[model samples]
Target: MSDKKFELSRRNALIGLGTVGLASAGAGVGTSAYFSDEESFEDNTLTAGELDLFVDYWTGANSEAIDGGTTGSGQNDGGVSAQYVLNDVKPGDSGKLVFCPKIVDNPAWLWAGSSGFTQYENDLTEPEAEVDDTGGDPGAGNGELADNIQVTVAYCEPSDDLEGSDPSGPEDFETVRELNNPEDYTLTDLLLELQYGYLLDGYVEEGGEWVPTDDGAYPASPDSDTQTGPCICIEWNVPTTVGNVIQSDSVEFDLGFYAEQERHNENPTSPYATGTTDDLYPPFDSNRALGMSIQGSGGSGSAEAEIHNATSGNTAFPFGNANDDSDNFPADQDVDFTATLDVDSNTASLEVLGSQAGGTDVTASDTDVTDGQGDGNALGSDTEWQNGGIPQTVDVAISARSLNSDTTTVKNLTLNGTSVSPDQLAASAGPEQTYLVLQGIDSSAGNTIEIDGTLNIEGDASGWSGIDGLVINWR
Candidate 1:
């Protein structure tokens, strides 16, 4: 309530890339002030007020000697750097560490009706204090540091994780606190606070159907007399295509476990402004973004597939996240070609359905076509051809590896035992980088292809890549 923020920092905590670091633990206390003014009769005597809130944590691994004791498993050096080390990390990687924060025997108090009333009761509830309720209102009244301690996490650059530096500096802290709670109190709230707080970026494709379901993630809150044990498990994932531009990019942070006296409610109008101003301190905020970063491997080799639209190995396919419905060709040239290949009978059929400027639509079938896994021998779908092209069917075998690649070549395309459009085959194969985007495999079909004007392909649905529902159906 005092609007005061207590920040703790760690310097050079090394969490290596692609590895999880041990849990870090540390603690500190917030202070309170008492003022007594004598405006009474001659024989009036007074004593000083008392208030002390202390908090400390024990890392899952080691216990150290801080406030004197024999040097145990580790050194209780104090501050964040003494707790744990977070090293190099990348996207899609996660790490965890557990620790507990407990309130030792400490003194706490709250002001009654007015500021400085000095009529102290047992704890916060005993007094049942009142707030102004006008322009600014003090939050709900609860006694002890249990209700007053405000904890928040801030993001910064690794270079800024310094000693004695103001971790709250605007330049150093990210404005948006990623750790947030949902609008309502659902099972997700418990799951987020207890298990997935480390997921700074919410649920991605990585978390397959990880919807929130209550299974005892968050325990009950601690009362004034008891100490609550909450674990802070920090995690990071390295992306598959991490390269030069992304290399060495680090995200530094400061987890400020702040505590302020509820006395602010007493001064309702002035300095004792009740409650914390930091948005990250709100209740049920496990969804708050964890300030983190993933370093790049600095390796190279074209992390993307090449889309060839024409010969000369140039004229790359102009495919984008959206469909280019505007680019419609008018007249049809000698562009009508079609072929149907029957793998079982080793027979083929060729027909010119229509005319087109480019290669005609082609359909390929292989009795042995499968997901390249155990599910074998199914009907193959037809290849989609763009730009006023007629459909052509071919009998051949296609593998999953070739489908996932950026570029694939259908060499020596033949019709009636003669080469048809060899150059066009290369172009089609190249642009079909994610050509393997399929839905569930049909009983008779090897793989259900998702393409424009096809049942498998949803014209309006969108996928993560901005492409239209082109999900890779990996068996």
Candidate 2:
């Protein structure tokens, strides 16, 4: 045999010799590096790490207000507020709230004639007045202003640790989130999971007739027909743990209105018009627009604590958009919304980066002999090893086949596997298919691999021993 001795570093020797009988060497290894044999090594090592969950803003529901001042032709600027009781949130955790508004109806007028016939009016002026002023019956005129409907959402999470006693008091109001400007906000990833609907409501008349009323109640006639409002539903994501709670967020909706008279100018002599008079009647057409707002808050609550169980594998919760019946709003009038939490830890995927020779095979090893077989062929097999311990080191021969097409340019290589170190790996420019030397084996008393530096593999066209016994772990 050639007198040339393989220069094995202290790290590699310890790692190679440490494979005495450990059975936890399969936790971080990948299937690609499995042994030539079909049998697999069963590993049972547990690792400790932190996880993060994300939440986003979304729209809820919308309803129309038919009350006196809340109807068509009238300006409605009313809102409702309620307190949400979180059962398990802890101090320091953060949360957010979002709100959205939708137009449930358009502004219009309905007229009842003396002949007991109903007529629909598009103008803000009376038909008889239009005829008297123009010498011929004219169509209704447009109203002074369009629909002026506005909606706002405000949230707070106060703490008793502060200078106040009442959590809901103004002094205690923390102002966690707000949705006053829908034009400036963007929706988060969680909010894009569901669909939303738009709606409009207004008044309509049957016929064009006018009757003098003894009482001067602005036309004095009741509407011939009343239009109902539409409904919308929203969906979003939420979290069940302390870390995720800080990422909880929300969305708000806002419906906009435009002046009907402005739009009517395009149709100066619309079919609905009777003559060329400015006397328009009630029931003018008001254009509706939909608006949206997204916001978030940061605070702790009882709800966070109840959901995050250290011992339990599950840590996710869900919430529905149904309103409390005691709130006095009709069930149909409430917005329909849904919230979900993504707590499955397995959903997270890992990636490793490094370069390997085409003919080289990465092997797996066990530190404890009692936990693993003696032969070095335990690539896919399980071996006993400590958590975060070094299980194996790779030794390969650099050759022409392993080099890139240029043969001189060092190619950035990537090794994909779990618990891999150097997290990233690379190879330098040299010859083709030559035995390249790779050293360093994590032999810390524990089975975990402590990788801190890079390993170089170099050779000529003749090629060298690609790699000998390599070790890895899988979970």
lDDT of 1 by residue, 1-475 (tens): 1112112121111112111112212233445445556853354445333222222222221122011211111211223232333333232333322222222222112110101100011222211233211111112111111111122332212122445353221222222222332112211112112221232221111232322223212221233234232323222223344322222222212232222222332211112212123342121221110001000000010011111111112111111111332222111122222323233332222232222333233222222221221112211111122222212321121111111122222233333344432212211111121121111223222322221111111111110111111111111
lDDT of each: 0.21, 0.19
lDDT of 2 by residue, 143-234 (tens): 10000111222433333366544222223333333423221111221111011111111212234222222221112112212212111111
Tell me how far candidate 2 lies from the true structure as C-alpha RMSD in angstroms: 36.4
Poorest lDDT segment (10 consecutive residues) of candidate 1 = 290-299
Clash count list over all predictions: 35, 111
Best by TM-score: 1
Lowest summed-lDDT stretch of 10 residues in model 2? 12-21
Candidate 1, after superposition: displacement of residue 268 in Å? 9.7
Candidate 2: what lDDT?
A: 0.19
The list of candidate 1 runs beyond 4 A from truth reads 1-83, 87-93, 105-226, 229-232, 263-475
